[model samples]
Target: MTSKVYANAVAALFDLRDGISLMSGGFGLCGIPENSIQEIRRQGIKNIHAISNNIGNSGRGLAWLLKQKQISAATCSYVGGNPDLEEQMLAGEVQVTLVPQGTFSERIRAAGMGIRGFYTPAGYGTLVAEGKEERVFDVPCILELPLGADFAIIKAERGDRFGNLWFKETARNFSPLMAMAARVTIVEVEQLVELGEIEPENVHVPGVFVQRIYQGVDYENAIEIPMYAEQ
Candidate 1:
């Protein structure tokens, strides 16, 4: 089998360009592809359509792109703690689409599953349902279309040359789903192991969904909100 490993994020994202729909896998500041985000900044790719959970929080993760004004639009579930995204949205610098957290995950999952659309009651009879197709089946539900992207950037705890991945704890949030939903999935792993190193049953996302893999360096892994007990 041909190895999917790349030298670094730049090499992995060689085809990345401006105005592409990009999916970033992470929840808040955890499990983000730090290297890839930095490279995108360095490369100065602009007018991006971003898809993620929080779009990063506390001025990290995807917030870096927001700081650079690279992202022109975003589809995400939450934006509370992300001041950069909030400022851009309020200033009309970025187009923001806020979906309910559950609906957001299902939309991405539905894309990967090849489902055209699905109906859910998560966003009904409110701003979310406005103008969207609605139906009544025991309860009112709004139609949500699949959310896919041209490329997806994700991080894994461990991955192999063929791109099989293993994520750590809450970090596993949206990476797998984004991997399956994107046309090309670029993954950065802290540990790049040989094939079969990860147990068959332990693989969270199969190599088939990933196109490129690299061993990352200098991860910040910042805590979004630090807490201490009576310290």
Candidate 2:
């Protein structure tokens, strides 16, 4: 129902406050909310905790937040590529909580389902098991805690004013799951169309899960990462 359009990135993210939890939906560079990420850096929101798969490369993606010293902690699966993030973690400026990839995905699913926790054996007998209650399953196992976020930033290939979303191939990435697990989900889309343009079966994220929708500008063609050969 709120079909307004914003002129720039700053206007879109002007309401973000310091120390809030954010769930950024992307795998590396795919499906990242580039414009909103830039706005967050420009706004200088500090002490933020991000739930994401991997921090983006230097000078791009969520790495911009680390470069700007805007993050206080990160709950992520991988954090090796960004040197500033590693340095900050080592210097005690940033806290890092590493979760197994499968468990991490399940936690977000649990959050969306309104479940408190789920059972997982991924981190048993390791540092991840510490401070968690244990219960016997087939032999002996315990469930880890569910994870959720106060806010989520995701990208969609196309979205309508009513908030129905569609995604492009790999860009479908984490956008769907992250949309449901957050208190507020903001969507950045390659195209913004009028309501009823998208087919019902084509909608990946329904309007109920999204709080904001903005048309992204300057979406470049696929970025080539030099570290690995293209798939």
Candidate 3:
């Protein structure tokens, strides 16, 4: 078998081009592919259709791309704390599609599973139902199509040369789903281990879904909101 490892984020994302739909795996600032995102900024790839949760908060993560005006469209569940996205969205700079969180996850999952579409009551009878097919079962339901991307950028706590991955705690959020849905999945890990080092039972995402893997460097891993217990 061929090696799936890359020297760095630039090598992993060498074929990435402008005006492509991109899925970024993260929840707020956690589990984001920091190195890959920085490389995309450096590459100055523009007109990107970005899909992620929150995009980024506090001017970090995907917010860097938004700051560069690289992203032209965004599909996400939340944007409350992301001022960059909010400003762009309100100024008619970036087209924003806000999906219900549950619906968003299902849409991505559907694409990975090869499902064409599914019906859900998530946004029935609201703006979300407009211009879409609606049906009444026990309750009103609206049709949602699968969401797929040309490429996905993911981060993991540990990965092997074969591309097997393991994520930590809440950081595991959307990485696996995005990996499965994208045509090519690029992953950066803090720890690069040998094959079988992670153990079969602990692999969060199987190697088959990932196309490229690299050991990352200089991770800030900034927390969005730091909470402290009162003494």
C-alpha TM-scores of all predictions: 0.97, 0.90, 0.98
**What alpha-carbon RMSD in Å does predicted model 2 have with respect to the real structure?**
2.4
After superposition, candidate 1 runs with Cα above 4 Å error: none
Residue 160 in model 3: lDDT: 97
lDDT scores of the candidates, listed in order? 0.94, 0.82, 0.94
TM-score order, best first, reads 3, 1, 2
Cα RMSD for candidates in order: 1.1, 2.4, 0.9
| lDDT (10s digit) by residue, model 3, range 2-119 | 7899999888899988899999998999889999999999999999999998888889999999999999999999989999999999999999999999999999999998999999
What C-alpha lDDT, on a 0 to 100 scale, does residue 65 get in candidate 1? 92
Query: Candidate 1 lDDT (Cα, whole model)?
Result: 0.94
Q: After superposition, how far is residue 93 of candidate 3 from its true place, in Å?
A: 1.0
Model 1 scores worst on lDDT over the 10 consecutive residues at 1-10
Model 2 misplaced regions, further than 4 Å:
1-8, 221-231
Give candidate 1's error at residue 63 in angstroms: 0.9
What are the per-residue Cα lDDT tens digits for candidate 1 across 118-221?
99999797899989999999998999999999999999999998889999999999899999999999999999999999999999999999999999999988
Q: Which regions of candidate 3 deviate over 4 angstroms?
A: none
Backbone clashes for every candidate come to 0, 0, 0
| Residue 59 miss distance in model 1 (angstroms) | 0.9
Candidate 3: residue 105 lDDT (0-100): 93
